[model samples]
Target: MANTNWAGNIEYFPTDFHQPSSTEEVQDLVSRATSVKVIGTRHSFNHIGSPTEVFISSRNLSRVVSIDRIEGSVWVQAGITYGELSLVLDSEGLALKNMASLPHISVGGAIATATHGSGFQNQCLSSQALALKFVLADGSLLEVDKHADPELFQACVVHLGAIGALVEVKLALVPRFEIAQSVFLNVKFESAVNQLMEILSLGYSVSLFTQWKGDCLDQIWVKRLPSEPSPDRFLNGIGASKAQQKVHPILDVDPVNCTDQLDIPGPSFDRLPHFKFDFTPSHGEELQSEYLIPQPYAQDALRALHAHQSAFDKHLLISEIRTIAADSALMSPFCAVDAMGIHFTWKKDWHSVKAILPLVESVLSQYQPKPHWGKLWAMKPKQVAQSYPGLSEFKKTIQKYDPNKKFQNPFLKELFED
Candidate 1:
């Protein structure tokens, strides 16, 4: 039903939209179509999965297929969102290691793009997959996991919607745990950048939100275990003060949409992510872009961004910086090294955002930044190729799985060779 991405910057009006209720239906649709692409929540800022011949929506496919308590794993239909799965996991007294700021995204889509949560050690969501099930080009089911086919497993985990339509995801789980979220206001941007790694390590998951126009970082969100000690200040108790009240990541928005904060302990499902899943984001007004470079370069890379504070301030709504550990998935940006994610949420002025992106990329180019596959980036196809060394192998894996190329789309076609 929705033709555009959540940001509404790119309009994708597919010729055919099919909502398949079960794997059988998905297989039927795929077999009948000449070409196809699958869409989850349509949260992606890019046109990565926009289909030319057919569009398959995962809306009706949300369900839990099985659970393995002894093995600590769960098999969920591709359409189930992290939020929905969280509820099921909570009942089972299990939890995921991390979650993105927004839990509204479907599990398959999140893993496909290697979406990650903020933490010094947490890998992207794709790393949690024990196995994945896809309906391939010929309406035949194919499954891959670490044990079955390590190479193909690694390749398809973050397949970018190319290998096939991901029908199911088998995710690893942990015992459910409680976390307390705290916020610090007005941290000195310079000092914060200097001790970026230390700040990120303060919690199980942490995020830094900023408005580049100012000298201070807007907020530092820390999600720590209940037993962890709280800090009164940072930079020898001079840079920031604890937030007296809950605050939204954006400037002047209502904090009601945000999760509980100020040292309140809550279930992992509630505290790990920034917002509650029941409420969908108000959209069509913003666009986002992100880059992940090695963690060692974070401080210097951040300094390079400040030089364009004026440009960022004019077109930006908010920006966040987070850390991600290296993942085994071949195509993941953080595959080779631990990374620091620099994210930009720009106001819906695509013209200005478009014009200013080259400048942003130029500043970050020295760090060998890798763009978030789900978000916007100005890098040319060749530059993207250079950024991810695993692309060639990834291409080979997909080509093997979908020999007919029924799952291919224009976005993937540009970067990959036949």
Candidate 2:
């Protein structure tokens, strides 16, 4: 049987798909192969992690190396999932600063692709990275820290699995805390956009959801610290009311898999992410595309998406608006400053969706939206690179690390060449 990605959008036919339990085995594979890539959890929707010929999977490398309580950091194998890491951390009375909506993704995969969680102050998951151990093209293990090599580290953290195979990652940690999640309903789209920042600032982490076919938004999820006062009726002036029962991000779907809501307090790990650790995130059968635009142009981008409502309304299940603070990773969508992500979750129909992406791109073109590296997109490579200010430096760094191009896959070749 052929191996496929989590979304089943891409299938792999590699010369070998080796599962290496130790870094030495991974190095051996890299040293012997003409071309190779590192596949972690296979969460990526694109071909970034699937090398055409040879590739190594880190699934067997799942282990928690150590936790430095004094330094407030946790080191774990690259294949460890955030869900698994969180449980380990929580048991020790520690936690990550933030996490992506779905915790099923591997730590290395999420960091390499710049996956982020929601919050005006919380940076992308990669920002918490203190140091990393990766196997270089020469089959040598190299470790880099933020302090010793700022420039290379900045470029390396989000390497897109192009430079090397990450073996271990060290991340900053925080004292465990409690969080409460609440959902508000029926907020007018105009009002939400007009006070978008205000709404986002309502809680520690916030997410706004809508279908784009109506005049008002469908729901707004506000996740907050236990000490923060819960809003019984959020956006009241804008006609938003507290949801009577549990609700899914996309309307009418089962909320059983979602995390606790209704302002009930729970462990930060269980509350920060939208979905539960064991449950399938999103609809389990959908295609996703997201664009992170400059925060200042959020209103403009929202207006642009709203303009094409008729085209996407039928094919779209829902759209989510989330925020992330500025980060230093070169290729990260929010590298320069804080960013607003406009994400679309569509009904699994790529034909219709692909046709509309260009129009969606055209509308938000003025704002220079940076497409998520791991999701689906139709933007030209040049257009995609234009949004990242440090693309040139990132390219140079890639050349330095993988000069033999052993890690270069067709996706990276087109991305860097085009």
Candidate 3:
């Protein structure tokens, strides 16, 4: 098995990385491990939920357990990725409400971190779960549902793979829909930020990509329902025009791996995501960090970023700005407040990144930004606790279920420790 994560940054092949074929096997393996952490797809850029002592993976547990079309939900093993789930759900005339830009990430990992897709109305992928089933530290199963166990559900839905090894999830679904994809070139930075929400709301999903040094945004990708209007007001901007060809988010990379664009309509599964599911990501080695600020402060935050363009210009590969709707997940960064995510995909230079990240955090401090759990962050532990008011309650709740702290990791330990 690969020693490092998807980004090839964190080396995490534990002495005992168990890949159990069934939930019972997971139970037995987890019960024997003195300490453990649950990993799925290993997509996280940081070591937040990576193994601390022993590790158990749901890799072999990928299977569709059941589908409740009547209730608009489908149950599946936690190992399944959004790419895999989308193909299955779309074929059955159902679909996910939203998905992160990259679909190869496991649904379990995405939710655990409250990872989101772009949209004015759609919440993070975690909110789609109607219920989840986990194998506790003692090899016992604990199932929580949104309707029946609301408090427990809110706490565990963003579990961070700490309380237990999640084995299965029942996700809420929507009727299958199509999205027409388009990209606008060189949108003015002034107009973009001045009317940020307006442009973002132009589509069911919208994303602005840039390198932070230019007067114009590199590109504005929009995924809209076919019946929606084109972004005419945006095109009216000086030097802005709709992309004549499909383009990659990174200015110099190949577009062959990206989804179909140029206003072509395709399955929501295909168009909603930036990359094609089948392509082995040649994204090359990269590191990521994100900050989620409350909606009211987003414009000011962007202007702050604009002031510090020099901080990122040399090492930054690209940055994606997007908006996510608020969700009820207790530990979610966007919990109960609509937020704008400012994500930076930096070149693999931890020496530079490690030094510069604190500076970036300092700039966004006024906004009280909440960093993504799976990405790089430099916020103080006390600040993290303050950002998520329920984090202390969350730690207590999970500790009640995982008394021995078998699933604890150093990343989580630092934040929650007294």
Candidate 4:
């Protein structure tokens, strides 16, 4: 039997999964394989990691290769999870500027999908890449940095694993800092609707959660840096009051897996992510989908989603709204445009979620929303190709790195099949 994804929504096709313990071993396996796909921790919700013949698992390859204090950067194996990296950095009094809501995802997988945290000024994870090392389709090790190979690096950083296997990554780091997380409850939907941008800018990092069944938001999670003072009782004007107790992002679920809330101060790694590293985040049985729309259309997008509350409520478990700063990565959803990501965490029934996505896409179509690369979506190849201005150039870069298409998979074929 093949393994299912972390959400258990996707059952990978039957194939040999390789666990290479070293760079030389990874190169050897790729050189001999007829087809290959690189996977990390199986956290994806779709068949993006499926392989025709062989799949490379980087779990055993994880290692913190170096930490350059002078350069303020860290070089880590692609398989290492952000949580692992964070702990190492914290011990040295260093940190990454931002982290995704879930810390379990591998560094390479997150960067490949342009995963992001909630902050108007914090760019997606890929933006932290100073350099990367890939084992190309032809078994050649290629290294590129942003300054020396801007166009190729931009395209390669978020290539969706279409170019090659990213074996190592160098990321920019910052001085470690402390943060406090607080949850505000029952903020009127109207207030969030009216002051959407202002509400998003309320903290160093903010996340608004709802289930679309009520007139008000279920919770508003705010993570503030030490320098940013949080209001004593926030969003009171909108009927939102700080939660007296810790709460999970999904209501009714135990908050044991979540980070410390109620304004308890902790390290950046602990507060930046919604879930704690020691416990599973969100419900284990769920499917996720997210769309990134430019900030200019945020209000319109919010209204559009709200209008379909009735239709979406039945299939949805929870939804979150987050903001990401603009970036220059070629295929990132927020490429060159600061944007908002409207994320949906749905019940385990794939059929219902699949049926409803077209409706969701149709309504948000006018906004030219970019579907997150790693999540489930019903978008067509033409629609995806047209959404990114740099798609053509990105395709060219993929071809240059993998002329024989050894890295190609069914998913890539469907998206790039012009």
List, residue by residue over 47-86, the lDDT tens digit for candidate 2: 7877777878888889999999999998899999999999
Model 4 ranges off by over 4 Å:
280-283
TM-score of each: 0.97, 0.97, 0.98, 0.97
Task: Please state the error at residue 60 of candidate 3 in Å.
Answer: 1.1
Q: How many residue-pair clashes does candidate 1 contain?
A: 0
How well does model 2 score by local distance difference test?
A: 0.87
lDDT of 1 by residue, 177-239 (tens): 999998888878888887788888888999999989767888889999987766555533747
How close to the true structure is residue 81 of candidate 1, measured as C-alpha lDDT?
Answer: 94
What TM value does model 4 have? 0.97
Task: Give all candidates' CA lDDT scores.
Answer: 0.88, 0.87, 0.87, 0.87
Model 1, which residues run further than 4 Å from truth? 233-236
TM-score of structure candidate 3 = 0.98
| Per-residue lDDT over 165-190 for candidate 4, one digit per residue giving the tens place of the 0 to 100 score | 99999999999998898898887787
Please give, for residues 1-418, the per-residue lDDT of candidate 3 as tens digits.
6777888888885878778879999899888988898888888988876786787777788888899988999999999989999999988988998989988888888888998999999899999999999999999999999999898899889988877889999999999999999888887788888888888898999999999877778888889999998875656654568878878998778899899998889899999899999987633489999999999998999999888888777989999999999988889998899999999999999889989999899899899799988898777866786678788779888789888888887777777777
Cα misplacement distance, residue 403 of candidate 2 (Å) = 0.5
User: What would the TM-score be for candidate 1 when compared with the true structure?
Assistant: 0.97
lDDT of 4 at 46: 80
